[model samples]
Target: MESVFEAFLSFYLNPGFFYGTVLVVLLILFISIFYRLFPNSGFSILFDYFFEKMYDFFEDILGNEEKKWIKTYVVILFFVILISNLLGVFLEILVPVFGNIADTDVSLLKKYIDIPTADINFNIAMALIGLLIIIFEQFRALGFGKALYEYFPIFGKNYLPYTRGNLNPIFDWPLFILVKIFDLIISLFLGLLEIVGHFAKVISLSFRLFGNVTSGGMLLAMLVGAISGLTLTYLNFEFPVLGPVILYFQSLLVALIQALVFPLLIAIFIKVAKFA
Candidate 1:
């Protein structure tokens, strides 16, 4: 178990692990304070209303039967991605405030805080988890036997029903045997393709998120690094500052879109599996 935990930690390599953990704790405290101060205020009412709307939007896709489970999963996924994305902004804020106080080098600060979703390993892990949920839903909806048949029909008892019971040895038996052999060959070929497709799903999902978040972070980092470098080299305390502002806003938009898109795709995958 210890080795497994280490392997998992190594896989994620969360740059913001410490800072992110601290932010999460601060977030919890903020929410607690908000509830205490304005339990019946318009702000709290509006917040609940917005949450309900978001929940209903996803619930509609999942339908009434599985809405609760699907909504819960989606909500959690959305917030996780959102928090990871916002961590970039949080780092930006902290750098200016804490940079002077901590007296740390710019490079050190950059190394410390990272958007978790920007890490390919983290995205891959999330994609794999989503895939597992998809598979679990398939099994829940179709049962083990039917789900297995969906993937590899040749092993299923009903794949060639005619070969199950005895038949006339001279006539019916010969045709049955031939059909069974043909079915087996076709199923085996399709099963291989099906396995490949499932693996493709994992890669596709992971890369989609990893590419978006990583690119956004790279752009932001380049902007900041360039500005900071010029300031140090030129010995100028002021710069246009518009470049970083524009980049920051762009990063914020990308973060929101990517966070929403990841969970939206997962929900769609679940829906497809349900109907498959």
Candidate 2:
């Protein structure tokens, strides 16, 4: 019991652990304070305008879908992803600033700031779930038989369409049987191809999102490391945050682009699945 308590205490009160929590609290306080101090401030207007533009942008990309909630969903997804990416910006500075402050070995970054988008597994899981939702939508819109046909299209026009072309009133039995066998093989092959294609789409989409996010984070880390001694120094009585902070601002565009793109692709896929 004592060992467990000790472990919990160590984890809870670890060095540099509260920095991120404190910063998050401060940020929330700042925003609330702004709203309180100036109810009609330009900052509030600018923020509202930005959100309105984001809503319109997503709505345009999503088109006039019946599920209007999906547009709201995409907007929410964009915000979640953008916030996650932006939160990871300070990782390069977080550890450096506090690593030496504590006599213990643990660092600030170790305790705080996990960018979920950078994880391929997280992205892949999201892709899988999103694909599942699309499939469900297709089923709901097109009924069972047709939805299955959309994927397999086993009686595909070019492949088989039907073996009846070889089996006519003349009753060429052997030729008909041969054609049926051949088409069975073709249908099996095409079905497998379709399955593989679905899996490939999930992998490709997940990897693309993962690569973009991780690359941005690594670029900032590399730039910070390059000048950690010259300017971004803990010993130089500096905050060690400027380089990372600038890189953070620079990354905002990519964050927005990625947030917009990921959902747009999913929406496009859903639309195609519904109509195709």
- Most accurate candidate by lDDT: 1
Residue 189 of model 1: what lDDT?
Answer: 76
Candidate 2 lDDT, tens digit per residue, 174-228? 6665667787677667767766867887987789888998787667656766666
Clashes of 1: 0
Q: Stretches of candidate 1 above 4 Å error? A: 1-15, 25-29, 93-106, 155-183, 224-237
In model 2, residue pairs whose N, Cα or C atoms come closer than 3 Å (at least 3 residues apart or on different chains), thus clashing, are none
Give candidate 2 misplaced runs (Cα > 4 Å).
Answer: 1-44, 93-95, 99-107, 152-184, 229-246
Count of clashing residue pairs in every prediction: 0, 0
TM-score of each: 0.72, 0.68
lDDT of 1 at 24: 54
